[model samples]
Target: MIAVWKEWAGEKLNESEWLSLLDLAQRESAEEDALVRGDLPVPPPPVSGHPRVTPPPPAPRHKVPDTPPPRPSTELDDRFGPWLARQLRRSGLTQSDLAMELGLTRAAVSAWVTGRAEPRSEVRRQVAKVLGGVQQFAPLERWKTGAAVLIGVSEYTHLPSVPSIKNNLSALTEVALTGLGIPHSNVHTVENPTSAAQVHEKIDLAMEAADPVSGGLFIYYAGHGWTDPRNGRLLLGLVESNQHKTWTAMEFDRLREQIADSPVGSRLLVLDSCYSGAALDTLSAGLSSASRIEGTYVMTSSNATNASRAPQGDHFTTFSGEIIRSLTDGIQGGPRVIDTDTLFRHVRASCEEQGWPVPSRQIGRDGDRVELMSNRWGQP
Candidate 1:
């Protein structure tokens, strides 16, 4: 049998390759035969004095030194600082005056304005509030008025099991989140999570840590979302074992519960997966305004029947790319404000121009209209 197998295997390779293949096959056959009879083989322990096979010493069990965590990588100081500086100058206040109002040292204010240092979250909010009141400083409108939470997930365990349409979806979300001023501290990217329970914990922690009084919360997911084979229930893929696993879309209902119980002004959920529209339906129904303050807006990459495609280059996923563009160009502060309807229109047009399918959504119970102030939208 061995001779016959080798002769056949040799037909596809050269002499040296055939020899190499034969050796590998023999080793595999020996291992297989050993396992079939339930034979257990034990190897000798490592020799302590052999230079080539020295025994390793037991590892020390000690507590690792607690180090201060690295600063979050929002990098907002570089891009937003000059713009803020200009706004401050136009406010007719010197750094000293601004510092006095913000209760900071002159040097600290100068550092923030000159990009020498980044301001803390509270300082950023104070600056926005001050500029928000000035009509001349209206260009910084969104920065001044609204606060937001951005969430993104990227790494997956089973690459093949990942959704075919959203390969670059996480990257797209990252770019959009960073560009739109969502602090890195708020961005959560899970890598190769192993269980549904882990997914729940990470998401719960992020949502719980979010600010309740800002503009809204944004959640972005990019991975394989599955429907339970048994019940046809939607599931968000999570890491489990050596393969892909899933969490029910219904799990997000807990987020709505938190929002319902909190004083958050508004909420927005962005999903990039199949049947994402359906997920929104489930989520919206779970959330009620009975105890909440504002409405929830749900945007999906595609309709329930469609799939969202990966982004084109360094750009965001089609829907998210357009949304970020709209935010950057249409909401950059000006007299003309871009309302939610207009923002969606822009997103639709941009997607249409790119020949990608348009995103669909169901806006639920929003009492106050969401708008972005943009000079490009024209006087409104």
Candidate 2:
């Protein structure tokens, strides 16, 4: 019946809605069974408003059904917020103390402690790290299903292509898949996508293989970028992208919508191209002024107005190379899990030291953390 309704409605329900529909239906069925078994009172019939003829019933109020609770993914954010709050108190750290340590505002720290707000994915990872150091906390569990799409375009038809992009792709694939131990079959690679259609197709294929329920998704792209002259929008350079032909470029806005619509619980997008931050601007435009999408993490190699770096004689682009290095070496401390926040901080500092364009980062929501690589076996 639900499938039939979806067919007639011309839209399938999201996972949350589908699960709620099933739960509500099950409860209704149980109630009907109880009525048939003579263990419950029958609901009263509606009274007619008309004097002689029965009046048509009022439309049903489609109140949103109660959703099931989400499974706990972390200690501080999920099941034991209050307990973690207590732990923070016992650790002799004031709300300000914790805030200063995490480089967050005291209000933000208070929100997490008082259950008013959850820590963003990277923040949550740091929370676990900080708390774990002061106290014996449980280690974070790795996602059961992990998938990645590594795309590179070194050969372009119109634009000055980013050279050695294939090297970037190869190194990234190894870092994310082989070095990180993401299943070989779960990783998708697209080399030199020649047109917009090819790029979209590969992204769609990767998303299709991803499982939002149990795991995460990782998307990495290394290429050139151009701002659409007509509207100041950013465009990703495909193999056939032409600076004069707007249609030939992949609009970063459309790419963002694709990632935003993904069902994955955790998503990591790493864009090693110029002006990729414009995509975040597109997503954040409006009265809200802030972009907040749950479970998505983005790291762009350069801001919307800056040029990304490609150091001479390097096999990979500067920003991309630094990111890969941080992931492989593990950030100074033994943070077994390398979150984007940690890696981006490292990258930004490195860029500043070397006079390269600093990278930009955005986190959509809390609890969407994706572990880039495990540092347990030590660096390779």
Candidate 3:
């Protein structure tokens, strides 16, 4: 009967409503079982209703049917306020102490502590930072159900070809499949896209092909990144991209909008291109101005004014090379899964040590817990 309802309800309702309907049915079924088992009291029926419905007949003690429970989907935001309050007390710090540290008013901190106003994702990250602790990673199952778009621009018509791009694409693909455990079918790749239109099409196809229930959407771009001299808007270059002609390249904001609009619960973006770091303001741009419903993590090669390094004779570009290293060599003593921010920290430290362009990073909402790959050596 539930299956029949699901079939009819699914056709009539949206995904969210259908899921809610199923959840309601599941709850009702559980309550009915509890009533039959005498675990709950049957509510008194009213005579004014359309008709009086008979309650379920009692069954044998051992014959109660087993039904799966609904998955826990409650937002963790409700707990954050209390958790922050507790952490502050445990650390023996007053609200003023935190306010000073975060450069906010005491009242603002109090709001967060009292659950009057919730901190945004970035602010939550800062809160975690002020009260320092090791980052906890998400479960490995998240990435196993995730999707990725590996884009490489190796050969350009108006620009010089960076032969290293092909390696970047192939290597990241391997990481996504093996270390990340993402299905090969869900991993999309576009190489040497000829025009900006093609890049847009590829993005559309990726969004269309990605499963609606996908755990996360991971997009990586390794190519020439240009900034519009007129407006300073970062552009992801294509084969036909002209450094001077702004219309020739795909604007970073376009990709940002697309990802923000995606239904995927988590998002991770990796860019190994010059001036890529300028696009880090994606989540803060428009939607929430911008909204991060699930998770958002971005790793960029260099700052807005800096150019990324492509070391000669290296297997991959400098920024992407460190990423490949993290994947192939799982961090020892890390958590069960390698979260995106963890990977970024590892890559940033490595790049800094080598005197290479340090990668820029941003983590918002639950992005810190968004896992990407398995830890070859770590505890659960």
Candidate 4:
């Protein structure tokens, strides 16, 4: 949008300090009102070569904001990745579903979504129709304003290695989450953190990177997890984490406190390890009225008592793999842009059907609206 505006305004637009035309117009009106009310002095009009600005044509009000103006179909074709990804997300259609419908391979759909390949003209039209036409997908503001800190400990110092944890980290940060339009630069990772301080360091950086008002922070931990036997407090294993020495592990409540104190109001935590669901009790208190944080949410791989799975030989852990599958494949009957609530439902259902430990979550204020990814179910 800024690029489009820059192309239109050219010399008139200040690249350093960019403000929306609507904001400028509103600010002008407010200044005029203040002048009329004797609250601010009215400046004399420029007497030289300065030109008075003309207001932009009125924008027709619509149910959605940030809806782009109509452009040539060729232009849409040029941005096939964004267009295809958006429709898939909004329609909740899966790559496999679309592939089956078009009698093409799922690889073809994935290529289209990722912009590695484009569909033929006729096929593009078919896809547009299948996903409720070629309407613009405008729910990306959340992704644009969001930042993530993914910490995965695949090879712990003392605990048994959950080798698939590496796959969980890579697939999520590099492939699945990026499909939602989050810039790769905005996603931070702590692959094999040595100590609790390193985990805190990554999260602190992510918090600093995100916008306090509109931006969100997503912190994911996928490795060995432990709970104190006496009180069930969740702890994430670091490289030197020991099962017997619980204090050697990264205390979740400590991380929770940092997140609660951070300026970013919208926050999410995705845990894919054993006893992760235990954070529910802690998050419930950490996100109470006393803290007054909004859009704080969680999704754990298992319940407070059960163990999460890694199957020994799979490329990805069972839980995180399911999440990647859900995002990539899309829920056929779900909403276009699936929120965490919707994601939890799909994951929980899959786990229940397979008799695996079910995922867990407790939605915070406006947490449902804090969408994490686009539903890929593009076809009915």
Name the top lDDT candidate. 4
Query: What overall lDDT goes with each candidate model?
Result: 0.49, 0.65, 0.70, 0.71
Off by over 4 Å in 2: 1-144, 285-294, 376-380
Summed backbone clashes in each candidate are: 5, 0, 1, 8
Q: Which ten residues in a row have the lowest lDDT in candidate 1?
A: 56-65
lDDT of 3 by residue, 185-207 (tens): 87888888876666566666666
Ranking by lDDT: 4, 3, 2, 1
Question: What TM-score does candidate 3 get on C-alpha atoms?
Answer: 0.60
User: What does candidate 2's lDDT look like per residue over 82-154, in tens digits?
Assistant: 5446557654457787788889899988777667777654565466445444432122233326677888888
Candidate closer to the true structure by lDDT (higher is better), 2 or 4: 4
Q: Over the stretch 258-354, how does candidate 1's per-residue lDDT look in tens digits?
A: 5455444555556665555556555555554432445656677776566666543544455666676575555434235555556666676677788
Kindly indicate the candidate among 1 and 4 with the higher TM-score.
4
Give lDDT: candidate 3, residue 75. 30
Model 1 ranges with Cα > 4 A deviation: 1-149, 161-215, 239-262, 288-291, 311-314, 331-335, 352-355, 372-380
Query: Using Cα atoms with residue i matched to residue i, what is each candidate's TM-score against the true structure?
Result: 0.50, 0.59, 0.60, 0.65
Candidate 4 per-residue lDDT over residues 48-148, each given as its tens digit: 77754433443443221253323222323345565556546655567898898788999989998787888764675456344432122333666667788
The alpha-carbon lDDT assigned to residue 41 of candidate 3 equals: 36
Error of 4 at 174 (Å): 2.3
Q: List the residue pairs that clash in candidate 3.
A: 288-291
Model 4 scores a C-alpha lDDT of 0.71
